[model samples]
Structure formats: structure tokens, C-alpha cells
Target: MSTHDTRNTRGRGATHMENGSITQHENHTRMREMTQRNQDMERMKEEVIRHVQSRLNEVLERALTDSLQSLSTHTQTHTDKTESTNNRHKLEEGKVFIARCSLLDELFEISHIRTIYHMFIAALFLFIMSTLAVDYIDQGRLVLDFDLFYYAFGQLGTVVWAWTLMLSYTLLGPYHVLRVWGEQALRSRWRTCVCALTLCAAQTSMLGIFPVCVVLHYQLPPASRFIIILEQIRLVMKSYSFIRETVPAVLKNTTQKDKSQRYPSLSSYLYFLFCPTLIYREVYPRNPSIRWKYVGMNFLRILASLFYLYFILVRLCIPVFRNNSHQLFSSRSLILMLFHAAFPGMLILMLGFYAFLHCWLNAFAEMLRFADRMFYKDWWNSTSFANYYRTWNIVVHDWLYYYGYRDFLLLSGYKLRSMATLCVFAVSAFVHEYAFTMGFGFFYPVMFCTFAGIGVVFNFAMNDSRKSPVWNIIMWVCLFIGQGIHVCLYCLEWYAQIHCPRTGTSFWELVTPRSWTCNYQ
Candidate 1:
């Protein structure tokens, strides 16, 4: 029995040992599974970190390349701009150099031309002086008032005895000289003739109004109260003719057409016009006088003056006769009369009848044709002061340039030259003032003289006025205000005088007391 019990105990012990082995195997399998899961998680985390690092590297690389490209483009653009600026500067310098070379070339040419120019100018001056002397000798005193002559011509016989001699000289003379001296072809000669004739015809049309007025004045009834009104109407027509006929001719091509079959109608007209004026070699007359061009320009200005004078006379007479009441009684009436009746009426007279309104209507007809200088490739275009003076009154400016400035420069020093310029301007201003006074009275002339003196002073004081826009505006404003005040004072006096004529005031009191020679009855 003891052996059997011992065997059972051994069996139990074996079973317990097997159970312990089985439990140990199960615990070892669970630990192995947990370790496999932890290892898998760690491997996944490492892969994620590596992938994130690779993406970050790619992004950084792209950012670096983009930044570099932008910097490169900016640098190239800036460099290109800098190079362009430098090139522009070089080009400007080159232009300056070329201009200097051109100036030297012009100086050499002038030196050669001066000998002839001076002698011719001297002759012209002598001729003028002689003419003046002869007039003084005949009349016992020089007829200083040029307006009298202008008026006589404008109001007397402007048509038949039209002074279009200058147009004849300029258009005809140049080609004549060229033909005689240059031995130009027959075709070229004809072309020149056409140009000359056309120009002359056009100029005559513009300037011929004064002569027409003169003729009309004789034809029309005289010594009547309406005589002034008739003259004014004729003057308006004269202005219209000037603009229509003269401006176009002056602005159009003054050259005759070549033998080429182009422009048939124009060519035919030019040919017809030029044939009569040509002097076929009778030793072509040499007119060294620059006065011809001056005369043509003067024609334009003179016609304008006459037309304007006519306008003033018309204004003075129209309201009195038309309404049977003084138009200046009400401010509205005065403004309407000046704007509608006076200014616009004058404009219409100048434009409607004037042939050249086709082109020059936009231009300053009252001023000078100096604006042509911007397009004119000549000596006068190169200077500031010359340009200004020329712009003021082109015909007169030309006269001063040839007669006054050049002669003064030749005879005396710089001081005299300056003085001569001032003198010329002053003389011109005086003439203008005196002429204006005949129609509008004396205030304008005084103001004009004062401002002209200022202009002369300013020309010397400031050589470069491009940077002086502000100062220029200020100066102009001051001059305008001063002139305005002066004009206002005269207007007041005139207004007072007009009322006095109705109020029984003494005529001497209404007028300047200084000029009155009163003989008390």
C-alpha cells in the first residue's frame, strides 16, 4: 500500500510539473507578441520621421531655388536699367558734341556771308534814310505818324495800288537769281515762277484790303454822319479778305511745281501766274534788300490794324445810331455790346472774309507770325531774345534785325548794341502806341512802353528762364494788374466824358486840361 501511495504522489508531482511548464510557455508567448507589437510601432514611427525629413528637404530645396531665381531676375533687370540710363547719357553728350560742331560750321559760313550782308544792309539803310530825307525836304517836317499813311492807304486806294512788292521780290527774285546765277533748267524756272506768282497773288489778296478800302472810301458817299459807319463795314470786309486770301498763301508752299505730271490743276494755275512776272535775262535785277519779306509780313499786320480800327469805329457808331440810346448805360448791355456786337463781330469780319482761315484761324492773327520759327530752319530760330522780338512783330523784327541790330553791332560796341535793341523796341512801341491812340486813344501805348522796358531789362537780367515758371507768372501778373489799373482809369475817364457830353460839362474839362487851348467867348 505504501508503494502505491508513493507512485500516486509521483504522478501528481509530474502533473504539477507539466502544468507549470504549460503556464510558463503561455506567458512566454504573450511576452513575445507584446514585444513584436512594440517593435512594429517603433519601426512605423522611424519611417514617419524619415518621410517627414525627406519632404522638408524637398520643400527647403524648392524655396532656395525660387529665392535665387527671383534675386537673379531682379539683378538682371536693375543692371539693364542702369546700362540704358548710361546709354541715354552718352547719346545726349554726342548730340551736344554734334551741336557744337554744327555751330562752328555755321560760324564759318557766317564769316563768309557777312561781307556781302553788311554792304547790302548799308545800302538798304541809306536808301531808307534818303527816302526819309526827301520826304522831310519836301514837306518841311518828317511825317512821323505812320498811321496817317496807313490810314490814307487803307481808306483811300488799297486795291489798284496794292503794295505787294515784297511778295514779288521774295517769290520771284530768288528763282530769278537762281536761274541767272545757277543756270537752272527751264522746268525749274517755270516751277519757281509758279511759286512766286501764287505767293504774290495770295499776299496781294491779304494785304490788298487797305487799297480796297481806300478805293471804296472814294466810291462811297462822304462827309455824312454815316461815313464812319460805312468805313467800319468796309474795314471788316478788308479783314475778312485778309484772313481768307493772305493767310493761306503765306502758310502754303511758295515753290512752283516741277514738270512732273503730278498736281496738274495746281501746276497749271502756278504756271499761268508766274509767266508774266519773269524777266527773261534782262540782267535780272539784284535786290539785296531783305525788305521784301518784311513788306509781305507787314501787309498782314497792316491789314489787321486797319480791320481792327474799322471795328473800333463801328463799335463807337453802331449803338448810337441803331438803338438811339447809349449802349453803355447798363452793365449787361455793355458786356453784350462788347462781347456779342464788338469782339465777335470783329472776329467774324476777319474770319469770314479772310481766305486763310482754313489754317491760321487757330493762330494769333493780332500778334506776329513768329511761331513759324519752331518749324523754320534758320538763324533766327537759334536765339531766345531774337525769337521773342520776332514773335512780337515779325515784320518789324526783321527790319530791326537787319537795320537796327546788325548796324549797331557793326558801328559801336556791345553797350551800343544793347542800347540799339532797346531803342528799336521803344521806337516800335511808340509807333504802335501812336497808331492805337488814333482809334482807341493813348492809355495802351503808355502801358505798352512800360512793359516793353520791363521786358528789355528782364532779357538782360535773366538769360535762362526755363526754370523760372513761378517768377514768370508773378511778373506777368504784376504787369497785367498794373496795366489793368491804368486801363481802368482811362476807361473811367472816357466813361465820365461820355456822360458829360449829355450832362453839359465843358469839353475841355472832360478832356485832358493840358491839351486844351480855351478861347472864352
Candidate 2:
């Protein structure tokens, strides 16, 4: 073999050896990279699994805790209710009394709520300024004369006299009758019936008939009539409650042969008559001391409210409706009037509620040192009319629920809850209409139709099932429209009666709405 051929073969062999080593090193490097990737992937997977397990554990723990809390709350509530039921007498099973502050009183403690009150006061100042500006523009002078107030509150002496008589009758008549009846050793069914009849007759004459007759005969102004009629209703309810509460104990005592049971003290009866509560109790939750400052503040608020109402009427209400009766009645005008009246109507409604429910009642409650200041509840928060009715005026509602609704249920053997509710609504509507009719000296049934008809329907429609804020808005809208309708129609009717003279003096003519036929324009 040639020497050159041997050298070339050796070089080729070296080259092949180098290439194989290089290939082996590359393969080892690739294997390490793949192993590192696998380890990283495994670590990531472990982290994901741990995260999932931790989240699941937290969710389970939360669910379990919530379930335990709910169970504990339900058990505690049930225990309290059971204990209360077992301890309370059957007659007093329904009514429960607890000392609590009014919703506004609590809300007013919060700064934000108090700011809203300040806003209302500011708005009232604006109203006063507006009234002054208008008076200057129209009459070249700022008229501050409260002529409407004077007219509405006329015949103060008659109101005072009538109120005194009614109160005296309520204080003396019902208590004496109950005392005399309870003193009987043997309360025979006949005697009981006679006593009941006597009470019914006396209440009808003194509380019911007397106030109506006086208002009609004396030609009392609207405010005076309201005072007398409201007092009349209050005394009536007070008397009924006294008799109802005491008679049950009397019968029970007589049956058990327990002579220790005597009539409730006259002092308690008088206190009940003046207290803010309509439901009568032998003993009530009372405050340790009266806060004169608080009482004074409430009265000041009431006076402010009165001025607020006056401005609302003068600026927003009277200007629109005073001359509206002279215009031809059309649906478009009526609708425009309704919408226009809505703002003022809402203002009036709120003012009425604040003045009467919050201010007046709170003042009286403080003066009496009545511990339970829950004359009303969070009615503004109510999304349903039923809830509103229940919370709006708790004093009257409690009386109606216990005396009127519960009694009807008892009489019907609890088989007619729906019927009982209807009856209660009817009674409330009637009383409202009756009061307005007497106060206004007209037979307008606007309140009656709205209250009994639309009110009942809304009570069922906007039930507790409505929980959304949309429902709340809808409830407020309904209130606005209702108030607008009431204010517009009543105001129109009032002016109509003045502008349109009656052609016939017949009973139907007297009761008929003058706004329907009056075209003074």
C-alpha cells in the first residue's frame, strides 16, 4: 500500500471519532434540558393542586360556619318565642311591648341623616325667601300674614270646650261602668250583656255622636274640627281598650274566684288617655326622667313643620289649585295638575308625617316619660304598602290589629284571616273618609276610594316578596301619585264648593261633588 493512502485513512478515522463524541455530548445536554422542564412542570402542577385544595377548604369552612350561625340564630329565636308563648296569658298572647327609640330619633343620631334634616331646613328657608319675593313682586310688599292659618284654626274656644267634655266623659263614664260591672260577685251572662250594651251605647253617644254633632252645629273650622274629631277618635279607642283589657281580667278573676283582682286605677286610665299609645295597659314602660330640652326641640320642630306646610301650601299648592276650579275640566289639565301637584303633595305628606308622627308624638311621649318611643317605624324604607301601613302609625295600627283585626279573627275562629284584613282596611278607610268629610265639610270620598280600593290592591301586589330597590322606587312613585291626586282633587273640590253655588238643597245634592258640575269659568 502507498504511504499517502494510509495517512488519509487515519485522518478520516479521527474526524469520525470527533463527530461521534460531539453527537454524544449534544444528546446528554438535550436530556438534562428535558429533565429540567419536567421538574418545573411538576412543581407548577403541585402549586395548582395546593391552591385548589386551599380554596375548597376555605369555602367549606365558610359554608359550615354560616350554617351553624343560621342554625344557632333560628334555635335562639324559636326558644324565645316558645318561652314567651308559654309564659304569656292567652288574652295577652299577641301584644308584645318593648322599649325602643323612634326610627328617626336613631337615624338623626347619624351625621348623614342629620345633614338631610339640615337640607330640609335650608329648603324651608328658600321657601320663605320665595314667598317674600313673590309678595314683593305681586303686592309691592312682603306679606307675612298667616291668614290661612288663622282661618283654619278659628273657633279655638269651641274646640277647647268640646275637647274638655269629651275627655271628661271618657275619663269618668267608661271607668265607672267597668268598675261597677267588675264589682259584681256573680257576672251572669245577662248582666254581662247589659253591661256591654250600656258601654256600646254610651261610647256611641258621647264619643262618636257628640263630636260629629258639635262640629256640624258649631261650624268649626278645618283645624278645630280635626282637633276635636281626632280627640274624639282617640278617646273612643282609649275607652274601648280600657274595657277590653280590664274585662278579660275581670272575667278570668271571677271564674278563678280570685277576689284580689280589682279595677285598674283611675290614675292609670287618665295616663292612658293622654299617653301617645292607643293600646291601653295597666302599667307601661316609662322613662326615668323627662328631657325638657328634647321636648322643647320637638315642639320647635313642630312649629317649623307648620311653617313648612304653610309655605308648601302658599307657594306650591294654593297658587296652582286656588284658581284651577274656574278652568274647564279636561284630562290633560287634570294630569298636568296632578304631576305639578306631586312635588307639593309629597312635601305636604312628609311634613304631616314629620310634624304629627315624629314631632308631636315624641313631644307628648317625652312629657309623659313614655319609654317606648316607637310611635312609628322605618316606614320610609318599606317597599310594600302593607309594610307601610303596619309601620306608618304603629299606635293606630296596634289598636286596629289587636282590637279590630284580632277580634274579628277570634270571632271567626281564625278561619278568615283574609276577611279580617279586608274588614280592617274597610274600617280604616271609613274612618279616614269620615274624618276628612267632617273636617272639610264635604262628602268627598277620594281618600276612601284610594285607601280601600287602590290601597288594598297594592298591599297584595307590592307584597313582602318585592325586595329590590326598584320596588322601593315604585312604592315611592305610587305614594307621590296618590298624594297628588288627593291634594289636587280635594283642593279643586274645595274651591268648587265656594265658586259654584248649589241649585238644590237635597241630600244627594249636598253629598254630590261640586267639582263634577262646576264650570265657573
Candidate 3:
């Protein structure tokens, strides 16, 4: 009985031990699974944190780059605007005086250029000989008659009187007004307006209306009319420059009541009136001494150029155009005439530039011991019409740029540069047309169209970006064609006006171009 009980107890004890081992193994496996699940969750949490950090970094970098780019662009725009404003201010201040010689004067110092000038003199002699020969052949005798010159410059007294009166007014009127206004203790806005109106009215009546009235009332010839009109324009410009340059100083001094401030002297004003430059200044660059010989030589050259122009007109222009009114108009004939006139027109243009801008201005400069002789630049080398206009007639161009274009920009608050450019072109065109109308006694708008229409188109189209030599050639070709058209059309109109009688005594009839309907009987 004891053996059986012992065996049963041992079996039960063994089974209990095996059950305890299985429970221990199951607990170890469960603990290992739980540890692995915790490690996996920690790895996923770390990966998500890294991904979020990377996205935030990308967003910050993009925002920073955009903000920097925006700042840079704004800075550049502000810098450009400031530079533009400064340039405009400098222009308004007045041209800086530099001691320099005229372009042609420097060129004439070269042996080769002097030879070319000698060639012109030789050509003038040849022209004289040809004229003598023609006179001998036609009238069976040699006779020198400058009937054209005499007729062209007929009204000398009227021109002198008008010019004297204009000069007197320009010298005294602006100076007196500025002096009186500047002496005032306090100038009100209404007072300033009154002064301005008074100046404007006086200028309009004396300088503006007087010259035109003289020309029309006396029936001035072409050359006389040109003299009066050109002088009128010059005096007007001079007066305006004087006022423009001094008024600011006057206002400033008067406002501050500066005892040290002094008005421009009478002697300086007198000198300015006679100076070659249109710009007025209290002082000008002067030469150490005047060379009367140089002045004489320049005057002689100007006389020679005048004779050269006369010969060109008689030999090349008159023969072709004098009888043109008798012929019926045709497109082919017009084309041929235009082509034929191109060379002569170009010659005249060069002659005019050389004579007035170079010879005459230089002569006056030498006489006055004026040092600055940069009357013109190398316009012939210009590749664009814009450059050409800037280089050619630098005197007038400076006036126009400072007064017209820059002032317009200031008035517009720098918002419309393109519009300012358009306004400048319009004003220039109007002035040119007015001068031509007054000079020629006709209302031809050819110059106006050329300046406002084709000139504007070319200015934009043939911009400074064009650097190719082909563009230069194209510019020259356009100039040739334009000059040809100007010559041909003006000549035709002049002759047609003579040949064609007016059907009515009306303003329209007078203003209308007679070349449109003149058919010779």
C-alpha cells in the first residue's frame, strides 16, 4: 500500500514540475515580444520626427529666398529712380563749361582735312570761272551780277531795326524784371504769378509778335525773313535761359534775405548777349588772348561758304527746279527729281552746318575770346537718328533737353517717361514747323511730320542697343532719302505757289499746298 501511494505522488510531482517549466517559457516569450514591439514603436516615432523637421526646413528656405529676392528687386527699382532723379537735376543745373575747340576747327588743323578744305576753295574758284564763262556766252560779255544775293537780302534796314529792338528788349526787360522782383522784401505767390505773366506778355508782344509782324508787313525776302526769325528765336532762347538760370538764385536769396547775394552785373549780361553760346552765365571760360587773325580767317571761310552755297543753288538747284512749274506732274518725274536733288540737298545741309555752326560761331568765339567752342559733335559718325539728333546742333539740343524733356519728367512725378519723350518730340516738331512756316511764308508741315512721326518711330526702332555697322548704313540711307524728299517737295511747292493762282481769298487757300493741284497749261 505504501509503494503504490509513493508512485502516484512521484508522478503527480513530475507533472507539476513540467507545468511550471512551460509557464516559465511562455512568460519569457511574452516578455521578448513586448520588448520588440516597444523598440518598433520608438523607431517609427523617430522617423516621423525626422520627416517633419525636413519639411519645415524646406519651407523656411523657400520663404527666405523669396523674401531676399523681393528685397533685391525693390532696392534695384529705388536705386534706378534715384539715379534718374539725380541725372535730371544735373541737367537742369546748366551745362558745365569746358575749354574745348570746335570739332571742325580741330579737324581743320590736320593736313588732310585742310586739303579737303582747300579743295572746297578750289571748287569755289571753278564755280566763279564757270559763272563768268556762262555770262560771256549768254550776253556776249563778262559781267558779275549777284542779283540773287541782293534780292535775297533786300530788307536790311527792317532787319536791323527789328534785331536792335529785340536785342534791347532781351537785354533790359528780363534783367529789370529779375532785379525788381529780387529786391522785394517778400514775394507772394500772386506776386510771382503777376511777374511771370508780365514777363510772358512782354516777350510775346515784343520778341514774338514784333518779328513776325515786321516780316509780313515789309514782305521780307527769304534770307531776310530767315535772319529775323532766327534772331528772334535766338533772343527768345537767350532771354529764357537768363531767367531760368537766375530766378532760382533770386528766389533763394530773397527768401533768406542774404545780404551777400548780388544780382548779375550789367557788364556780364552785356557780354552774355554777345557770346556765341545761348546759355547765360555770370562767368564763362575765356582765352588768355584773342587771335584776330584766327577770327579773320574764320570770317573769310564763312564768306567763302556763302559763295559756295550760292554757286550750288545756281548751278545745281535753280536749273532743275526753276522751270519745274511748267511741266506736268508725274510720279516718275517726281522720283527722278527727288533722286537728283539728294546730292545737292546733302551738300546744302553740310554747308549750312559748316558755315553757321562752325565758321560763324567760331569767329564770334574768337572775337570774344570765348574758350568753349563745342558748337557741334561728330554727328556724321552717329549710327542712330537719336544719336544724330543729340550730336547735331548741340546748342539747341541742350536747351531742349534741359527745358523740355527734364521739366516734363519732373512735372509728371517720373511716372510716364514714354509720355515725356512724346511731349518733347511734339514740342520740337512744333517749333521746327513754326520756324519753317515763318521763314518760308507757307504752312508746310513736312518738317513737323518728319520730326514727330518718322523721327519718333526711328528713335524707338533704332535704339542705342543697335551696334551693328549695318544700322549706320541704314541711318545714312534714311537721311539721304529724307533730305531728298524735303528738297523735292519744298521746291515743287515753291514753284507751284508761283505758277498756281489762288481761287479764293481765304486762309485755307493760302495755307494749302499749291503743288497738289498745279497743272501747267
Top model number, lDDT:
2
**Model 3 — TM-score against the truth?**
0.82
Better of 1 and 3 by lDDT: 3
Off by over 4 Å in 2: 1-92, 185-190
Off by over 4 Å in 3: 1-93
Ranking by lDDT: 2, 3, 1
Q: Would you list the clashing residue pairs of candidate 2?
A: none
lDDT string for model 1 (459-519, tens) is 6654444344565554444434443434333343344433433323565343442112211
Candidate 1 Cα deviation (angstroms), residue 49: 65
Please give each candidate's TM-score.
0.30, 0.82, 0.82
Whole-model Cα lDDT of every candidate shown, in order: 0.42, 0.87, 0.86
Stronger candidate by TM-score (1 vs 2): 2
Residue 197 accuracy (lDDT) in model 1? 69
List model 2 lDDT by residue over 1-521, tens digit each: 79999999999999999999999999999999999999989978876786799799999999998986777686988867765565434534666667788889867755689999999999999999988998899899987989999999999999998899999999999898888788862447787778778988998999989999999999998999999988887888888888888888888988898858777999999999988988888888888999999999999999999999988888888878886767877797799999998988998999989999899999999999888888888888888888889999998999998898878867876557788889999999999998899999989999999989999999989888888888889999999999999999999888988888688889999988988888977
Candidate 1 — which residues are off by over 4 angstroms? 1-387, 390-395, 413-415, 441-444, 462-466, 475-479, 482-521
